[model samples]
Target: MSYATALKRAARHNPAWKAASVFKVAVEESGAAVLDASGEFQYDLAEDTYALRDFTQEERFTLHQPYDGDAALTVITANDPNSDHLILWEGQFHKILEVLGADALRGTVRYRVKALPQDEAVPIRHSIIL
Candidate 1:
């Protein structure tokens, strides 16, 4: 039910996701937070991006987009005290949407969309396979 457990489980069941995640490695930031892969919410990340706690190597990659603000990637560079740049896999996550979902940028799916059904209803599919 927790991030560590979920990562472990994914590693156990999904062999493809083993090295793709941080179970085998000694990650500096290991915690819960949703992560999108191939334009899908593949990982169910914890609600708080800055969850008043440590972030694993994976969590630091996502850029948080709240309901009421702009989206930008959060990175703790080598100079920071609490976080280390060594743990940061790369600067590739600077673009939040790209890191979140590669498909999201290529007309596959929209990363953050807020549209309430007014009169007519809109259909939503759980997964998009292209």
Candidate 2:
């Protein structure tokens, strides 16, 4: 079997080896205001929700690191030029501050990512009880 194919299979099944994943990305092109049903004008961000939806495999890099105080908090897509890519999770948004890549050896690439602070926020259920 080919090494590249084997590596791809591993990355797909190994959760420990994967880092930040781009699930949904969005970007607004016009940045125009729209009228709501209540007759109020509101800025539309619906188009800005999938900016990175087209990320290619070569552009995806993630390094899963243990929870350490010194781990990096920012992640960048190495091959993408867009500087405003955002990571959407649990109804919150995390903006990608920079672009970065993973080191590859013999057709395998690995990279790291820092989790967004929003993911650490107390759960709504716990907050409601308190």
Candidate 3:
């Protein structure tokens, strides 16, 4: 079977896939934004670290790592012109920062995204939640 078909089947029958949350994508057209796609994918927070130093003589510091606002998403389809698209996941909007990877044979793509500032985020529509 083709990779896409296999992926579709897995998404339908796999327990892990069934537990994943759905995410919506919006694309701009004619000055209006419209829903372009929706899918279920594995979402995870990307690791981020910060260095904190003591005020004493020695230049010593510790890494204060945490899950930053950024996240990694793996999906079955690619969002073209990613910057122009907004993803609504977990009741919040996120902007795609970059494509991490894509595998045609596997029918999957990975992306790095950061949550949009509240002022810039569009409200999520009830119809798009699914």
Per-residue lDDT of candidate 1, residues 7-117 (tens digit): 444444643321210011122245432333443223211111110111223333345853443232222111111210111112111112222332312211112211222
TM-score, cand. 2 vs. native? 0.30
RMSD of 2: 12.7
Cα lDDT tens digits for candidate 3, 1-130: 7674567566666543322222443334464445424532323222111111112332323479665666666555422324444555445556677766677575655566777676753534443232
- Once fitted onto the true fold, the runs of candidate 1 whose alpha carbons sit more than 4 angstroms away are 1-4, 20-130
Error of 3 at 101 (Å): 1.0
For residue 64, give model 2's deviation from the true position in Å: 28
Residues 1-130 of candidate 2 have per-residue lDDT tens digits of: 5554455455456543333333222213575434445644322122111121212343433478543421222222223333333343334544444444333433422222333566443211111111
Relative to the unseen true structure, what is the C-alpha lDDT of residue 63 in candidate 2, on a scale of 0 to 100? Answer: 70
| Residue 123 displacement in candidate 2 (angstroms) | 18
- Model 3: which ten-residue window has the lowest total lDDT? 46-55
Cα distance off (Å), candidate 3, residue 39: 28
Q: Each candidate: what lDDT?
A: 0.23, 0.33, 0.46
